[model samples]
Target: METTPCRMFPFIRSKTAQSKNTELTVNGSSSSSALYKSNFNLGTILCAAAQDSPQKTAIVYDDKIFLSYKDLDVAARKFASLLMTGNYAKGAVPCRPEDRVAILLPNIPQFCIAYYGALYAGCIVVPMNFLFTEREITGLVKDSEAKVLVALKAYGTEPTKAAKKLGIPILWADDESSCGMQALLSSANPLPALIPTSPDDTAVILYTSGTTGVPKGAMLSHMNLFLNATIVPNTIRPVEPDEETIVLAVLPLFHIFGQTCMQNTTFARMGKLVMLPRFEPGEVLRTIEKYNVSLFAGVPTMYIAMLRCPESDKYSLGSLKMAISGGAAIPVEILKEFEQRYGIAIMEGYGLSETSPTCCSNSVRQGRKPGSIGHPVWGVEMTILDEKDQPVPDGQPGEVCIRGHCVMKGYFKRPKETAEAMRNGWFHTGDVGIRDPDGSYRIVDRTKDMIIRGGLNVYPREVEEVLYMHPAVAEAAVVGIPSERLGEEIAAYICKKEGHEVSSEEITEHCKRYLAAYKYPRKIEFVKELPKGPSGKILKREIREWHKKMKSKL
Candidate 1:
């Protein structure tokens, strides 16, 4: 039998002979087994890839800037030297376990330099979204107790003000003649060597979007990130070091997907990443044609926009092999249309900031099944539990819980929250899902999002799926709005097709036939567009809050 690579090594045929770092091979064929290994540091993985492919193009932007492994090393060294000249100490930066260093920048080389530089200096990196409001920005900075903030020229004001309010210094990377990279690389100083970080050391303090309330910092360790990046790519496909993989990095690096998949994963595999400040469908298609991009990752909204692009067919996207979708659920209809049109499959995955953002993903080799979030990644365990916290039968909807290496250390400084979320050694994902007989999982809806109407529980996804079947409906989101009679009533927010028109009565009538009497949406609102997060995820919490304010006015 021919041998193939395994993402996670399987155990020996004899069960009792397992080793910590054993590589499993079955019947003289590696493809038949998975590999089991001990955890490694994420920094080591990045440096190793940089060393292995010293001359390959690492990043490409508007002007086609390419950073060879050697170049990145030297540039990082120079930036490191500049950082060392500051309050940052030579060894480990002497930070308390939860100390945060805020990073506020756009999708430029400085973001990476500042990010890795902070980590190399042994300070916990808090990557703030550059689009945050002043109050929101200050709240996170004060909450995290960030000592230093790095901001790009375009979005430096908010960070500067926040830093000033908090009595912290801001490092601005604004240059007319040269960019942040030019300034950092031109500095005459010796870069410090990489810090010796343990796998359990807190590498980043990723602040959640705070969709629910004030955002809380998710403390991810080197091990948490290392496990995710190492396992995700290997399971999806075996990437060769010499393969010239061009990745379209439109997703923000501050988000977990872009950080792990595009930044760290690309670095580990020695692939080239083409950066974009934001997603413009035509521009993305043009860039794809221009650079011959091979790999792509984005949220569902991007795929929808790209498909709706009038000039989508004008570009030759034959180079695209795979596209990964996360941040929100990908509609099966959209997935089919994209695959049919572009000859590329968008593999949908599921995760949260609490789990390094990639707990499950559809496998490229194993044919994607519509609506499934695929199997669990290597060294991770997943289970579906009922409201009572007891394991539910297969094919039954329940809350998804995750455990193992990819699980975050915990919420930063929120011991009560950490304890509540990680009960019984499993991080309780608020999202509800069901496991099929084949071990694939499908998310039903969020546990908190289930609507209770006159004592009957209705999963919002069930109602949304029905609404999506409507011919005129372009997008739909279901939420529970407070009602005087029913306690909570199902409210459907709809965005219709450009030329089509639909009324609230028609939507309610359409739902009545396809859904249970109580499951049908009682109230409806038609909007030109749905409110979305930076990643294009429908902000359900934001919608719910808006509904609450409207009801209050009534």
Candidate 2:
């Protein structure tokens, strides 16, 4: 077989552009360790380091499934081979180049294989939340115009029903039965050629939080994701050659924050990724202790849960060096307690799915303020904008806008929405933020979520901060509930610490100490837990809905 000429990613070839201090040999390749690329596809490059140390542990799941770099490559390629060649068991799906393939699997080994394999086969990947219901799954598949569905047997008949309704084939993961990922991986067919895909091509379509309406798919290009993945590791802190960073991957892989920051970054450096299908505080602690994981990227709730875990001191988490907190603005109280408890700092950042989920981040080398999402990274530009879409002065709160290489191509098939978000060459994040004198940005609240109480605009974050100060409060969320007298009254929902019997009266009294009389939550609720999105960001919309229903009943 003759080989066609295909160049590696252009950035890697420019040796002069690379930093001499940053240059370190990796993957047994002459290329600088910072540049991880292959066939201009996100999948192929993941295995480049496997060529160097095929035996280096690539993935670990539940302390049971351990796969080396070589094993991961073989499985990823074999799955890609199955998709491209279409030679598989009866009723298996056959996908052509550029076909949109929806993946609905938990954070299992198959999820990684399918994620990279679909990209390798020149198919656009649509990673659906494994927790999505049948209807939610159908909506995403229909919206993306997916030609096939790759899911797991644990999803029951939801995928089958959705696939049949959509007139597409469904392939199951983990199972060895017909049309299963295991069965296909065991096939004797040779791995297929890595289909050519342009850098501008959309590699993945990540769905945003459907807070306003139906979730829009953010189309991220090959260069969009690849550049962000490489830029993040080096721009923050370059990992030493001998220090193979082990990342605790508890954040759902389907979410953009976890997918890019945790999963993709781990593969770029040929580091070990310890996967957990779900986040159980004790289980996560045990896994971290077992693996000696150094780096962890997680949301605020996960950190809260770990710190609040009664047996947290039992595990020796001294191996942990850094913890990244994103997805939502973490309460300053939670951030401090976590750092104090774990003896590690939490690097907070801000980004949306449309921005490939990370643009502004607290630098590892630079000093970090408790709540401020430190300055824009590398080529990314971040500015606070007024209502008129013009830049606001420093210390003035406004909409957060971002423009950079990490931004998505557009919202898939939503030209009008895309135009609305990408006006004036910047992706307007609906969240409100203010820049401090030091160039760090602090989020006030989502513009839509802000409460106007008796003509006074009260940001929920301000009230939540006071609630977090209460010693009994483990987790807290503040929202605006409709008020007959005041237009909108502040409501605070809190999950108190274990063994602490906190009351609504105590919470309301405590908030009065720090917050202004108008900003204090008059309506205090003690709940077992808050509704969270895939990345553990508390969903305020659900709280509103629940309040409305409860009031109607009363």
Candidate 3:
């Protein structure tokens, strides 16, 4: 039995916010209108677009599968309809809008349908990385208390293990089985009523890098996501009205960078998002040449990888007009070389999962500055503040704090940590940065010893925790070493237990079994003793400096 459409969806069409431009300010001065409608539900970004252009192509899957806006809406409705059955649906258990539903998927049409579908049902979406190991996935599900897990068919056995362990219902997409996505979508049941959510209600719970402690989930509200998503497309890098916006969504959709920047922005713009599950330099070139992709939202290493591809010049990627660089800093030399080769301007930005993943970015207009993340986007206020929360003088390095509409609601289930992070009315990003004379911000370094390898954040503590579990390992300190190809390469320095000898190859392979492929340390250095401060804390900075000196000599 399905709820009546009229009762379920109070507004069949997306409603515009009453105070349209009421949510923004420029550097704490002039007020700017909200970029997109924040008053409405996030799912309505697709609904409004579907109603406007039902037959327009919205999703392209590896250039094989295509879904129009109407099809996507119906698909979302179908997926939502399954969740509405209150245990009557073949695969899904009763899922209320308040319950968390963790999504584990790669870049595919199902990722879009499942994400929006969860939002459509009024459920909080907890997006998980598809490359996570069984234990990692299990921990996230347990932490988030996800009642129902939606995953693609190719996820292998990890999802099943986690679901069974958690005693939760698992819905599989791309499968024709009874518990598969198609079975639910094919149901004749009507769509459920929309569970109206407040703008401040948490829309997504994005997990932060657990460098200092266990990864904390950042609670991003509907307004937070909506405001941040709009700034990039509307102000930072607006697609020309006549241009058919084709975004290369190669970044993992589970991360906030890809979700808000590529996936949501494309749908909001009523443009096409080409889904590539995993990034391959060769295939990326092929997809661009085949589809004439206009927007390439990628990290610094991706650009380096593409340039290093053996078939680099074999394919014509001339269609790319605008590019976005984030995740990690790109060497100015590499940035210049890439633009010259690709003939596209790569605008740099800085953000984290907490700030809807975008606090400061370079706009397409006049404020563009290479090697510097441009001024705070409309409605967002960014500052370099000292420990006392006082604004530091310009050109001086300090903690980057962002206060704006895009700031996350708080950290989920961890109020103390949230208080620490969101103290004094500013979300403190533990990144050392300087505010240049032109108000543009440049990242000097990270206060937190986090590593960005190939644009994926590799928290040293997480890797250290894993290494500590090995029987042969007594103590381990993980650090990042510079690399031209990858922004940084992970290196683990270990002091083995007496009488226990383990080969580096064995340790690396062991890590591969437990961690993601990119997370495993590429180099393992056996040391008798690691440098430590008087307080007994490992001196990671000293180790980094040591590596730099050694590399220079080599």
Best by lDDT: 2
Over the stretch 1-554, how does candidate 1's per-residue lDDT look in tens digits?
A: 11211111111112222222322222243311211224334556656765687666777766445556555554554444445444232222323323566887767766776676566544678887888777887988888888766776677667767766877766665543333434434532333345455689888888877655567788899988877777767887766565677888888888887888888887777777788978899999998988888888988888888887888899988998788898877788778889999889889888888888798888877768887889887778899998889999999889999998888888888999889899999999888999999998999888788888888889887888888888788888899888778788888888887788878888888999898898998778898888887777888887888888776321
Least well predicted 10-residue stretch by lDDT in candidate 1? 4-13
**TM-score against native, each model:** 0.87, 0.91, 0.75
TM-score, prediction 2: 0.91
- Model 3's C-alpha root-mean-square deviation from the true structure amounts to 13.2
2 or 3: which has the higher lDDT? 2
Q: What is the lDDT of candidate 3?
A: 0.76
RMSD of 1: 10.8
Name the regions of candidate 2 deviating beyond 4 angstroms.
1-39, 88-93, 552-554
Candidate 3, residues 1-554: lDDT per residue as tens digits? 11122211222222211222222222343222322223457887888888798778888774456777866777676566556554323454667766798888888778888788788777889998776778888998899998888876677588888888888877776667654666546542334334467788888998875656688899998888887777656778666778888888988888889999998888888888888888789999998988899888887657766876778889987998778888765556556767788787788888888988787888877556877888888888989999789999998878889898888888889999989998989989888888988889988656767688899877665577577668787567788888888988999998786788999998998898889999999989999878753212356778887798787321
Candidate 2 local distance difference test against the native? 0.80
lDDT of each: 0.74, 0.80, 0.76
Report residue 476 deviation for candidate 2 (angstroms).
1.0
Better of 1 and 2 by lDDT: 2
